[model samples]
Target chain A: MKVFVTVGSMLPFDRLVCAMDAWAKEHSEAEVFAQVGETSLCPANMEYSAMISPSEYRDHFAACDVVVSHVGMGTIITASEFCKPLVMLPRRAELKELTNNHQFETAKWLEGRPGIRIIYSDGELAEAISKSIGSDGGSIVETGTRGKLINTLRQFISN
Target chain B: MKKILAVASAGGHWTEMMLLKEIFDGHDVAFVCTMEMYRSEVAPNRFYAIPGVSRLYKRSIAVSVAKLLFILVREKPDVVITTGSAPGLLAIFFSKMLGARTVWIDSIASIEQLSLSGRMAKKFADLWITQWPHLADPVDGPTYQGSVL
Candidate 1:
């Protein structure tokens, strides 16, 4: 199985990257690739880069069976669009991983959503990954909502 | 075709704006985002990158405001829209001052309440929207049209 891990473009999420790398080391059967994003820690067992082009990011998202990420909306939305199961860990404000605790709020709000799993600590990453494999991912995108939003914008722009 | 200036900060905000790409079809759409590399994603259309600012980064706010004002005066777009954070809020404020119609779609990540920037946007935007239906109200806007995600 192929797994893709991303820490997002703005901040370095060493906690998530290091945990996944440790998991990768133990799970030789799984192929792992990561977009590490300027983190000081390097993953010895997984393929990694500091950043990738937007198209490359999409290509990785499309190719992977599961996505590992911080609880960022971009990752969540993209994973939903691709129907890929997502395993997320929220960045803690006290840890200085992000400017605020909004990620925690997002995680709480997304608690029971299908095809997505939220793990609070790095220690839980491995089990979450295991649970996510071979599962059909959930979608947050609603076609009716998209249509209504588009129609409203079209009318407002034209008016 | 109307000239539309679409602004978003990087990451989730940019993703939301791109998902609404279909709305800009056949119109003249220009994009302003935080990351320089994002220019590749919306090529052939005019694109601008500015230093991103947040409540934590109060120092950069002046630079962003000046840059957004410059873009607004130069583009003179007929309409401006953002799926936002701070930069988009600034864009909406400047665009309104420039006599362009403005729309602000709050980021879906702001699930509990409107984002600080989204709240500020309600004052300046011609149309303010929230992705979550529960956040929408008839008296207090950030009306829910629907979500991009």
Candidate 2:
């Protein structure tokens, strides 16, 4: 089983790296790839965890058993579009890890959506990974309406 | 009567707000944002600058409140629309208190769920817009506008 994790901008890179390292140690049979942000807090481990660029971001999602991420809007929808089972950890405003508590809200919103799971802490993340190991990403998202949303934006801007 | 004050924290929020700039072209339009190094670089419309709110500075709620007062007294917009981070929350809260129509647009990236701001905004907003229908499940009311931007 393959697990992929992406921490987009505005998250605690060090904590993510620690979580990934701990997870990899416990599940040595599974292959895990974690992409830390530009300013990373990555430990010295090339086998399981490493930093990656945005260009290479999508390729891993295609093959992973589980996709873990911070609660960024971009990362969440991309996971859905790929039909990947997603687990998200919200960046907390109280922790000074994010600009605000918006990630908490975003995580709560996606808590039980189809093919998606919200993981509040590092322990929950490990459990989500266990659940997704053998499972394939479920149903495709109907993003056809994204065009309509864009159209609405265009009209809203043009009007 | 449809004066709209769009508030954000620069970057994606500002870019997202720009997507709806045309809607305000025909109405009274104003912009609100935080003082950021990037804000000077981004070419947002002449906007009102508010103190930034973030997880690190949660204690700065007093500063946020003061800034909100300044904005409320200065703009006095009839409606407030936000694609939020933190400053947008201040706008929504003040808008509600001052009797202005409030609309909150959950970001397109919110496919998995509503952000924390979206949840609070959903409660009191005159219209809460979400690009993802799944978000409506947790919203307490029927005022979801289904993604105006």
Candidate 3:
């Protein structure tokens, strides 16, 4: 199984990167790749970059079986496009990870939506990782499921 | 031949704009984004990299708008679309002044309400779209269109 982790560009989300690093050390069988944005957290058992180009970002996302990401809409939507189930960690304003706490609101809003798992505390990262893989057997979302998502977008456009 | 001008900043804003790529197929699509990390992501089409603008950077907003007008005159697009932060709003506002049809698709991450730029767009846009249904409930602002995401 291959896992891709990304914290959106702009802020340094060290906590998420560190948590994933620890998780990967436990599950060495899984190939872990990360786009850590601007951070100094070194992964013990993973390959990572400070930042990546857009095309490189897309290529990594497409290749991964599962993705761990921040609650950035850009990352979430792109992950869904490849049918990659996600474990999302939202940055908190109090933690100085973000300018505001909208990510907290995003996590709350997206709770029951599709194949996403939201992790607030770092301890739950393992459970969410296993759950993401279990939900889809480490496979991408099938085309039929993706088609249905597009249908909803069409309906809204017409209305 | 319909010419469409798509505008946004480089990160989430650009991602949202790209989600609407299907609609721009076969039409002349040109992109204008803040001068940042994306060097040629909007490939195979004409793209303009303009100065960065943000609510936080009030001092530079005017120069950014002036630069945008220069592109507007040169491109002459028939339609304008943006998923915004700050640069997106200026693009749509100027395009509307040039008689282009303008659409504003607010970011899905604005979980509760529309972003401040989305609200400003309501005054002049031909169509206002929100990813959240509740933001369109009052029916006075952006229409609750499902997300392109």
Candidate 4:
């Protein structure tokens, strides 16, 4: 299995990266790559970099079977675009991992969505990863709403 | 062709703006984002990178605002649009001061409610939008047209 982990460009999510790295250490069957941002924590078991170009990010996202990351909307949208199962761990405000608790709110709203799993604790990371290995990925269907939005904006701009 | 300033902070806001790339077709478009590296994504199109700030980063907000004002003056776009966070909100505010039309698309990630920035953008945005239809209200608005996601 190929796993791509991202913590976003703005902040470091050491908790998520550490959990995934621990899991990677025990699982020789999986190839794990991470975009860890500018963090002090280095993953001993996974290939990681501070950041990757947007195109390179897309390339890794397209090639991955599963994605593991924080409750970032970019990651969520990209995972859906590529039909990849996603395992999300939200950053806590109290932990000072993020500016606020918006991620927790996103996680709450995303609960029970198909092919997406949200785990509050890193303890469940292994189980989530194990369960997602062979599962069929999920995709966001392009809806007519998108076209209408484009048209609305296009018309508004032209006028 | 109208000059359009497309602004978004990095991460989801930038992602959402990219997904709406079609809106920029045939228009004179310039992009503003938080991450300098994203210049490649909108290559050949004019791109500007500004310092990203949030409410928590109170100190940096002034610096970001100054940069945004400079861009707005230089571009003098006909319209400014963003899938927002703090920086986008600032762009919308400054764009309006410059007599430019502004659109604010609340991030899809704000499924529970409009983001803090999105909520504040309501007053400044000439056309406010929300991805979730349920969040739209005729009285206050954040009209639901469709989602970029």
- Among the numbered candidates, top DockQ falls to 1
Give the poorly placed runs of model 1, Cα more than 4 Å off: A140-143
For model 3, the stretches where C-alpha displacement exceeds 4 angstroms are: A25-29, A40-45, A137-159, B35-41, B55-63, B137-139
Please provide, for model 2 over B44-107, each residue's C-alpha lDDT reduced to its tens digit, 9 standing for 90 to 100.
5446666667665588778878977887777787878788876687788878989877777777
lDDT by residue (tens digit), candidate 2, A33-129: 8776544455443243344433356678777778877876656556665778777777776766665566776666566677777777787777777
User: lDDT per prediction?
Assistant: 0.90, 0.65, 0.78, 0.89
TM-score of chain A taken by itself, candidate 3: 0.83
Question: What tier of docking accuracy does candidate 4 attain?
Answer: medium
Name the candidate, 2 or 4, with the larger lDDT value.
Answer: 4
Spell out the clash pairs found in candidate 2: A73-B109, A93-B55, A105-B114, A105-B115, A105-B116, A106-B115, A109-B113, A110-B112, A110-B113, A157-B22
**Residue lDDT tens for model 4, B34-111:** 889999999899999998888567798888989999899999999999988889999999899889999999988777
Give the alpha carbon lDDT tens digit for every residue of B2-96 in model 1: 99999998889999999899999989999999888899899999999998888567898998988899999899999999998788989998889
- Candidate 4: pairs in clash: none
Judging by lDDT against the true structure, name the best candidate: 1
Q: Taking the true A–B contacts (Cα pairs closer than 8 Å), what share appears in each candidate?
A: 0.84, 0.10, 0.37, 0.76
Ranking by DockQ: 1, 4, 3, 2
Model 4 agreement with the true structure over A73-135: per-residue lDDT tens digits:
888888887888889999998988987788998898878878888999999999988788778
lDDT of 3 by residue, B71-139 (tens): 899989887878887788888888888988887878878878778788898876777878776788555
What are the per-model DockQ values?
0.72, 0.10, 0.42, 0.69
Residue B104's lDDT within candidate 2 is 77
| Error in Å for residue B136 of model 2 | 12
